[model samples]
Target: MSTTEQLELDPAEVQAFAGRAVADAATWMATTMTMFGDRLGLWRALADSRPVTSPELAARTGTDERYLREWLAAMTAHGYLTHDPGAGTYLLPPAHVPVLATESPAHIGGLHQALYGLTGMLDRVLAVFRTGGGVPINAYPRDWFEGLERFSAGWFDHLLPQVWLPTLPELEAALRRGADVADIGCGRGRALIRLAERYPAGRYTGFDVHPESIAAAEAAARAAGVADRVRFECLDVSGGLPGDYDVITTFDVVHDAADPRGILAAIHAALRPDGRYLCLDINSSHRLEDNRGPVAAYFYGVSVLYCMTTSLAHGGAGLGTCGFPEHTARELCTAAGFGTVRRVEMENPFNILYEITH
Candidate 1:
């Protein structure tokens, strides 16, 4: 055989490749179905419930039986639900309730919704790939912001006060004593509001470049009866922060900034001499080889579709999602005039918390 003919793919290898491709397609479809279930309250209805026929689940959720039947089949086939062939019913197992129910911290339904929204930006993202720029934050679908709010709620609600704050004893003490605090890139202002509610004496300010997010944060503060203590402003800290604060926080914010160093510098300047700086960002490796796994894949995907693109739109350095790992974080903090950078001993799958001091 000629050299070119000999290089042809073996039948077994071709079959394996095809099988992998099919499996990936199935996984994609499963994710779509997961989002559908989340949006329609199907998962919520199934949680903690006994095995039921599709018609029964449909009736409970006020959805069409035909659609429910297909959805249930898809969920079962994808192992999201357990199928009882003998009883002709389906159920979300007790073990899976935490992963499906919104009330549970382990629920991942928000991520499914967020991914669905991110996929909608593919057309614009494709243009950026061909051209040399990216889509702006405002150009994305409104659902993207809404989905992000949902996806991040669990962290702020469950982890912030209970798990994360206790890890920083000094910061926690200051918060209780009514320290002036500021949260940069405070999307929707939930974190500040939560803090304000817990530490009623503490005054809080939140800043975000997005006006809509600022407005939403304001509304949330009002609704939570913390507006007097927690106020949000639409400001780009890349220029500089206006007020000195006892504590400043940036939650998954730096990587998306047009000028991360400038933001860090601003934070350094805005903090009091003995103030604390809390940074909650993605946990990944500075080296690409060490950043393998599903989490890394998710971060990279989001970086391309959202984080990196938003920065590029602002003519930024575009650090991307996994840009600031522990090493880079320490380096940036040091350059920004912070004297110390300590990684807090808080274990979280999606984020790493840092306590920085000058």
Candidate 2:
């Protein structure tokens, strides 16, 4: 409708929706600013470390004070930083350390970086909207993959050791007794490396279609000192896996695969009898109505930005981010000839872990 063509509207509803729209737009732009803070080491400098004046931060970080001043002020306005009018310094609250400053599982910096990198392909993604193709995964900037590594570092470092493994006695025992494990779509190999480091008996393989990721994984494995037992290979499991394995894992990967069902079936065939498949996927509902909320919104956004597009780019089934919900997971696993499909008991809001066997 034209601007001149006014329709009857509820004033309260209009105002509320308008406010939400503006806030969301502001948050979207703030993500880029957050990337700047992360890349420029501003967050680290203020992360429960010390309060600093804009000039002081500029001097410490080798950045211009003019930009730093505006950035500091913006952060303060956004509640990421608190302004001290008396001293003209800004402080990052200790409470915000996990979400902003640190490089832990709780850190939000990775999300910022990932989003920034992914959105950089807006022109290409927009083109795909009209042309019906997608931006290739390799086309994405290094920051996207690095951001993903950082984001996943939290799960592999903290939860995988502490919660994911400990809860599964059989899998844990298998690892302890030298299980041959493959982590498909293993990205940078951090997860496999972490497991190799923790469970020395397990021989781990990291697989990915991306050559750069495979190389990076190899380097990471070497750096982590797990190179002896851990290896990284550039492989597309949608074709077939190399060997039979006691345990197979795909952490936050299936939905992004161009051929998830085929990969799952290959995984099923590749696993030894009585072997377990540990599948970590997005925790989502099959029905759209049940999937309402900001969390689901973010999931869809990332799917469009990276997951779905990459899969589509490869001419595979675009399962997107939340495409494989719990119900869908069960269906896919059952179709892949898995005898058992049980959702692992984990109190995670963002992901669901499954135990599958033939």
Candidate 3:
């Protein structure tokens, strides 16, 4: 037999094997969710002081060490736990608990539960796609909102105030000089409302297509006592961004758009001469190498599956082609008549800080 023919395997069989493996791996992610016991503080109890054996941890935390040991083994394999055979102890580090403990804003234990729901959503994706109908971004029930609010309010809120805020010094400076600012596709307008509160002199507008979200945003602005300076509009940015603003900001919005370029152009038009355009979104595709580490990759997959791609399919403009890199963003800005474009690091992890000049 020819060398090529001899070395070739059955493509169908190979593909079938790989397909099942992938499915099983995804299922494993959901299965891991069932063991939320460790996430809920069981591991923390074990690692609290000197490393304790599983039986002692179980007694301390009022759990069954037998099953707890199994959980520990799983977590150990996942690197969330360190097993010391010499001491017969299991430990979870502080780094692992920051995202697990409910008290912290970065607590991602709730999101881990959300991932289980996304798995179910994945099961329904094909049917929804076939019908060409989409589940709303608000499809999840009220409890999901409660969970998300806990996750988002803490994570995103902290991120914006610390990271994204500093990146806006130039825009803030322009706005202090009396420039209108619009945060297009602002969901709930948390960031926009905050900016409005800070820059009392600047007009702040938030645009989003979901009426429900817009209402919530307006209410939030009112509650924040910036209703006078802040306004919420229910509109699709794909239609076009309104112009004459000194600064326009889009946070985590571009990657979820079906037509990013249209919005980019619209934002360009909306800017005053020499205005600044700020974009903040996940640094996917562009910085995949820098971001492809395990934890980041996992969330990126979740965003693409449940957030980005689903947003487009759900009767909304989809994030097209996972968005452009920093250079690509700069090029797009230049193409849109922006004279200069720069990227900076925002407080948000793996977030792109775009500074474009018109």
Best by TM-score: 2
Model with the higher TM-score, candidate 1 or 3: 1
**lDDT of each residue in 1-358, candidate 3, tens digit only:** 8987888789999899999889779657634643365345674464353577888877888877788788777767766677899988877676766656444666665565555456556745566666655555656443333344445666356665666656668766776676688988777778777776666888888898667778888888888899988998988776677657888888767766656777888888888887788777666555556556555666566655555555666555554334565756766667777787777754445466777786
The worst-scoring run of ten residues by lDDT in candidate 1 lies at 101-110
Model 3 residue 47 distance off true place after TM-score fit, in angstroms: 11
Query: Judged by lDDT against the true structure, how good is candidate 2?
Result: 0.89
Ranked candidates (TM-score, high to low): 2, 1, 3
- Clash pairs, candidate 3, are 163-347, 243-270, 244-270, 257-318, 258-317, 258-318, 312-318
Residue 342 in candidate 1 has what lDDT?
95
Off by over 4 Å in 2: 1-7
User: Which candidate achieves the best lDDT against the true structure?
Assistant: 1
Worst 10 residues of 3 by lDDT: 140-149
Root-mean-square deviation per candidate: 1.9, 1.5, 5.8
lDDT of 1 by residue, 32-94 (tens): 999899989999998875899988888999999998999999999989899999998999988
Better of 1 and 2 by lDDT: 1
Model 3 alpha-carbon miss at residue 46, Å: 9.7
What TM-score quantifies how close candidate 1 is to the native fold?
A: 0.95
